[model samples]
Target: MDFSLSSEQREIQDLAYKFAKNEMIPVAHEYDEQGKFPTEIFKKAWELGLLNTCIPAEYGGSGFSAVDGVLICEALAYGCMGMNSSFMANDLALLPIVIGGNDAQKKKFLTPFTEEFKIASFCLTEPGNGSDAGGIKTTIKDGGDHWIINGEKMWITNAGYANLFVVYGTIDVNLKHKGISAIVVDPKSPGIEVGKKEDKMGHRASDTRGVRFNNVKVAKENMLGKPGEGWAIAMATLDHSRPLVASSALGGSQHALDLSIKYSKERNQFGVAIAKHQAVQFMIAEMGMKVACARLLVHKAAWMCDQGERNTEIASYAKAFASDSCMQITTDAVQIYGGYGYSREYPVEKLMRDAKLLQIYEGTSQIQRLVMARELLK
Candidate 1:
């Protein structure tokens, strides 16, 4: 198989890397400390066509391939995943439109954001259910000509900042997965309330909150696909998003290895550079290997998506393996620094914090394992 990137892909990667280093890196720490969203950075990204990379060209987007999406995500994540997530959440929010939205729905919801540069979000998790997603208790009751939604979504990324939301709720509680329905909601709707942003352990810069829908009236026309299609829609969205999550993890691991190697080369111990010590050399070597392997998985999944192949199994493998490797590599980076690694002054501590959410969100490491196994056995 040809693994080399096309010229277009290479150019996009270089642009993303340059933008992250020049624009994002300088402000990453400040935003992390303040737990604030960087509107200016997002606006710049939107201006650069970085924010709406996955939307179709006819819909006023760059129409980048899936591999291009992963490449851009990796570079942006190299600077900061918290900020990267704030940007990448657009991908999750727009997935339903790309996957199943009718032309009018796409034109009205997807096109405006791509052209006007507004943020979007996907709402799936609720306080009672995340990995057991089918347990979501959010309910949508039919009203004459409109659907009145009354439910609360928890840990919603981009909740406060998003202009549009692709939300899912159950239309019939007795039907289990078959009762689920997906719809688009405007944030300014009369009954929509976004709670205070949650104080998170990591990815603090990304907006997270509880969103309450209180008798919010949405036209039946806003519904995506047919009722009872939410499960299928949700799965399709994850198929595209999982690889992007893996790419973010891969970037964090790459940053950790780079920092560890640089420090080992310069730090002196027992009258010699730490890099000269076999133990230190071994640690870096192991971390490097993990990063390389994880990257391969990420790229392979992205390539599969570009080929128009259904990549559920490979996507699960990449997400599970890359997230686990990132956590290990970042932790090793901290261990290599001895006491200094634990200090907030060092970048490894930040890497450790950022690597954690990779395992928790998008689907936990355990959930990914289950998905991979189920697909493999079938």
Candidate 2:
């Protein structure tokens, strides 16, 4: 088993991290404070082929494997997870098409994204339920020439800014998962209402809103697979996306640890540098170990995905462990910074806020555990 990155992978990693450092880091705090999306940064990233890395090469994307995709996510996320959400959310929105759409569908829906910088939202979560995807209240019905959709989707990332939306709805509420369908819809359609952007606790720089669909018309050509296949497509997208989420968690954890280590060496306590103290050393030591272990899990999951293996169990492991570790590591980083970390004047506080959403989104940490349990029992 080779542990080292290929030279090309290293180059990708370096470029992403450098872009994050140079472009994202400077404005992350301001964007977070203002609760604004960093459109210019996203434009720069898209131009460099860093934003839409997952669309197939045939469609003009970088065609990076899952492992390659995670590497880019990790490095960019290291700069600012909030800003990184805009980048990562693009993959989330596009994955359903990549996973389930036919070649022609890909050409029509995904090709334009690779050619130009655009935003999209994965509309699965609803006002009724999030983790219970089958419980979504959104409804879709046949309209002969077009599919008519009516419902509300909550906590939709990139909703306010999205040019397109991959919507999930049930044809029959009684059928639950069996009745679900996935359709790509243009947000400009009549009866589509994009709510005001959400005031989120973290990832504030990412555009998240509630989108309401009132009999919105969708092209049949935009349907993903046959009807009633949306649930499977959504699950498959989540399974593929969880690894990138884990990698992003790894980025946040690594960033926090770096800050903690730097702060510890410079911070003085009781006549000595905090780095010289055993208590601080122990926290830093545990953080280092946690980051390393989480990275392995993330890479393992991404590697499995790249190998065409179904990784439901391992993806859960990575997502749960890495996101939980990120929350812990960022918290510890604040502890190390000792009061200043609580202030917006420091970066770790923002990281702490951002790390939180990692656990909550892309399947919550508790949901990840249940997934692992189900896989094991099965």
Candidate 2 Cα lDDT to native: 0.92
TM-score (all chains, Cα) for each model: 0.98, 0.99
Q: Which prediction has the highest TM-score against the true structure? A: 2
RMSD in Å for candidate 2, one decimal?
0.8
lDDT of 2 by residue, 85-119 (tens): 88888899999999999999999889999878899
Residue-wise C-alpha lDDT for candidate 1, range 1-378, written one tens digit per residue? 787999988999999889989998888888998998988998898888777677888888788888899999988998888898889899899988788799998889888887686888899999888998888788888898998888999888899999999899999878889888899998899999999999988888999999999999999998899988888999888999999999999888888899899998888999999889999899999999998888899999988888989999999999999999999999999988988999987778888998999999999999999998899889
The worst-scoring run of ten residues by lDDT in candidate 2 lies at 45-54
Q: Least lDDT summed over 10 consecutive residues: which range in candidate 1?
A: 45-54
